[model samples]
Target: MKYTPHAYQRYAAQFILDHPAAAIFLDCGLGKTVITLTAIRELLHDSFAVRRVLIIAPLRVARDTWPSEIRKWDHLSDLTYAVAVGNTAKRLAALRQKAEITIINRENVDWLVKNNTFDFDMIIIDELSAFKSHRTRRFKALMKVRPMVSRIVGLTGTPSSNGLMDLWAEFRLLDMGKRLGRFLTHYRERYFLPDKRNAQMVFTYKPRPGAEEKIYEAIGDITISMKSGDYLELPKCLTNVVRVEMNERERRIYERLKKDMAAEIAGKEIDAMNAAALSGKLLQMAAGAVYDGEGQAVRLHDRKLDALEDLVESANGRPVLIAYWFRHDLERIRKRFPGARELRQEADIADWNAGKISIGLIHPASAGHGLNLQDGGSMLIWFSLTWSLELNQQTNARLWRQGQKHTVTIHYLVMKDSIDESVMAALSRKDKVQEALMAAVKAELGKE
Candidate 1:
């Protein structure tokens, strides 16, 4: 098909062509893949600047999205690429092929760097947020060869999803520690104060006064951000909260577990080893079950399950997509709605998009990136809440993004007073911080 670029797409592609090191925080459905690919085509063939390019992305994306974009566009017909995934032999064979671009999943970055010579002159990280932790093996291995690459681009929708702390490692990879700093301890000391800490150990940190603006300014020069709302006429998105309450007996059991870290339900004993364990147990209980010492799920109440049943019935033959967080959530949901389908394999995704599945189930982590389900349905139900802002936003974008015809409605099943509420609150706070970061560096096409 002939490619016609939007004004913002033209600007984004030009931004990549101009800058050697850049970070583009593009919202979902903004055509980021095409933007980057257009620039790469120019660099590889037109300018003769970069001979070899590497694109590191999530597994499914590396396997499918990039190659599809290359094939879909008539302008990029000359670009040849090979995917370096699967086993060691397949990866090595792909690397040996005569291709201008090589695509590999993030999991194999360590192996690729350790076993082979670093040959790519330019590298693109499709989801730069994956390297938020400097201690990760992929981050460490890539850092070792950072200086060898002449050009680099970092792309993500949720750059500071967790907070400003995430930017340090991500920017370090893009600019070689020129923007944020060389080390994390220095970055933390300059911008953050310990929020949750003991005499010896600090558990969490909050930004110091004016630190957010300062940090944004530091990275503003090389970073450009754009939201989909500013560029696309998307369909309406509605978020509704369905609150469920427990009876006196169920409340007593939840309170016992919260206060003493141990409780009994259905003649099964459940105990939490620590605060983290207790939080998980409470979340499980809020969802109508808790895992006992034997790893067996003990039923606490069916409040959530009943609410879900109401939601599914209210759909009234319209397809419903459910996002679950726990293994037992899937089991219980499937048992209740026997017609529900889990969107796992390629066939399931194809079937869901074709309107063949009435109800589809997915986990937030699994559906976090690079899978498009907009053709399936517009309604998504959060059977369980997640603490990660990235997962929640990405999962919602699966249905709420561009090409979705109907108004997207997201339903959350929140227990009135439980860890479910806590998780929702945390995601909101983190989203606010991330929003500020993006707004501070929002892109203006003609000004710069």
Candidate 2:
């Protein structure tokens, strides 16, 4: 396909060409992959600045998305790439192959860094937020070899999905602590105040006055951010809340679980060991099932299932992508709609885009990033909710992205007066924080 670069897209590519260590906080559906790839093509061929490049991404993206993008674009056809995934033998074999770009999953970053010679000149982290934790093995491993790489790029839509604290680890890997600080403790001490702390430990932190702008200013020269609404003519997205209520008996069972942290539904004994376990159990019960003591899912009620059926039927043959959370939800959904297919493999993704699957099922975490399903359908149904703002936004972007033609409609089956309501509220609160962070560093591509 011929590539016609949008003005912002060109600016993003130029930003990468200019900075050795860069962070691009681009919104979903803004073609971050292609933009970064374009700059990489120039660096490899035009400038002859980078001989070898490494891209770290989620598992599926490493295996499929990057290679497919190289093949899809006419301008990127000259770029040679290989994917280093799977077991050690396969990964070693791919690493041996001479290619301009070598792609590997984030999970194996430690193994690659520890076992092999770190030789790539340029590195591109597809979802930089995945390395937001300084404690993770991948982040630690990448940091060990960070000084060796000459050029690096970090790309993400939800850079601060949780809060400004996430930017520390990310920028640490990018600029080697030049912007945020050398240590997480220093970053927190400088800009944040302890929040929700006991005498023993601090649970969370709130930024001090003027901290957000200070953080943004520190990273402004290296980072460029953009929102899709500000650049692209994306299709309208309509969200609907399909609320469901439980009957008296079901309500009593929910209340019993909430109070006692244990309840019996359909003769199965359900128990929650702690506050966290109780929250999971409550969400399961809200979704019409709960795991018993023996780990068996006990059916609570079919209110969500019935509501889903109505939405699927009303689609009237229009393909509907259903996002589920639990294994029990997938089993129940599959049993309810035998025709429902889970989008698991690359073949399944291709089939979905071909419009071969009418009713599709996907888990938000697995299908969250780097997979584009916009060509499949515009209607998405969240049969169950997730608490992560990153996963929620990424999953919704599957069908509501750039190439989508229709006014995408997202349906949420919220169980009233249940934990589902809390999840919805939490996602909204986190989104506001993320929006503020993005606005602080939003890119201004004035007059092209």
Candidate 3:
């Protein structure tokens, strides 16, 4: 329980010590929470400059992270912590009371700012990407309080998911128009492609050479970026694709549904315009959902179910983390892998980690952030793939993390020659695209 700083944590603590107004861009499972806490503690102890530390994070993380980290480190026992969730009056009272640290979800930040709540010495924005959208009320409120805050730290695994524009909002909060300038649209125009061919007219950016270096020089001293692969001695991740050909019965049902959908939109000439919707319906059917008579989902293909069974059987008593995309997928997985625990069920995750349960079903979106399931399992089997690279990476980190004892092996069950292959390709290039976008932003700022 004592504050046994890991090597990566030590690096983070040192970075924070050197630059108090810094952001830690550490990977999801790289112990950013503990590092931030340690840094806050050190800052408080070293100088009488900092008093109360405010942590802004997602609801689940806000409710769980502070207390959990405090309990994990014995050295942090003296630090008092309070969460703002229930009874606004009570939470406000608790905030007014002298507490070393207070954590609140980002959703409530606007309300707190509007009410003129307690001022904080150090403010930490966990999962900072949530505030990437500059037009949001939360971003506007946080911007107003930027000048008042003494030290601001932004933490995120995917800082530039949407693009370079995401950094403007976070940087504005951090340094207040000092770093990355004031307007995102202006910044985009200065660096990105002028002409976008799409109907939406979305601009794309190509990072000029040396752009990353310049950005690093601008905020490099303040921001510490660390990847999990660089720190954790994680297990070898082996991605195996299990392609399931649609059975003749399921194929026939899928074709019928497609034909009916086409007929329904025939007068309207629903061609490529409605292709996405039509394809989605077909995919749903392929995944085991049948339109039957009404719009209700009915089971059709047991191939996916059979694949899951084979995976669970091969687990060899080790806990298996199953990533399911659709609700129908969840139902099929639950039915096929009986006694398999779902991540949302509090008792189930606890039991699974305690070695009482054999398998855990996790939806990528739900199980994506702030939960540490690595202690329980090192195996992840993706029953399906989504277009999101962030979700895929986050889900994989559930097992391939710092605290994990074993090497994590990721098995991806991809349907061959289907949309699955294209989705995976898109997922693979997303990170690279994000990196390019960030570099472009850095270049634009460098020119300024």
List, in order, the clash count of every candidate structure.
0, 0, 2
Residue range 194-245, candidate 3, lDDT tens digits: 4455686764665445544554455655676776666666667677778777
The CA lDDT at 282 in model 3 is 55
Best-first order by TM-score: 1, 2, 3
Give the per-residue lDDT of model 2 (tens digit) for 1-448.
Answer: 9999889999999999999999999988888999999999999999999999999999998998889889999999999998999999999999999699999999999999999988899999999999999999999999999988999999999898888899999999999999889999999999999999889799999999999889989999999889888887888999999999999999999999999998888787888999899999999999999878887888989999999999999999999999999999999999999999999998999999999999999999899998889999999999988888899999999988889999999999999999999999988888888888888787888634
List residue ranges in candidate 3 displaced over 4 A.
87-90, 116-118, 194-196, 203-217, 247-286, 290-295, 298-300, 433-448
Q: 139, model 2: CA deviation in Å? A: 0.8
lDDT of 2 at 153: 99
Candidate 3 Cα lDDT to native: 0.72
Q: Give every collision pair in model 3.
A: 1-74, 235-407
TM-score, one value per model? 0.97, 0.97, 0.84
- Model-by-model lDDT, in order? 0.93, 0.93, 0.72
Candidate 2 residue runs with Cα over 4 Å from true position: none
| Tens digit per residue, CA lDDT, model 1, 1-448 | 7999999989999999999999999999999999999999999999998999999999988998899999998999989999999999999999999589999999999999999988999999999999999989999999999999999999999998898899999999999889789999999999999999889799999999999999999999899999999888899999999999999999999999999999888788999999889888999999988789988888888899999999988999899999998888899998999999999888999999999999999998877899999999999999988888998999999998999999999999999988898899899999999999999999986431
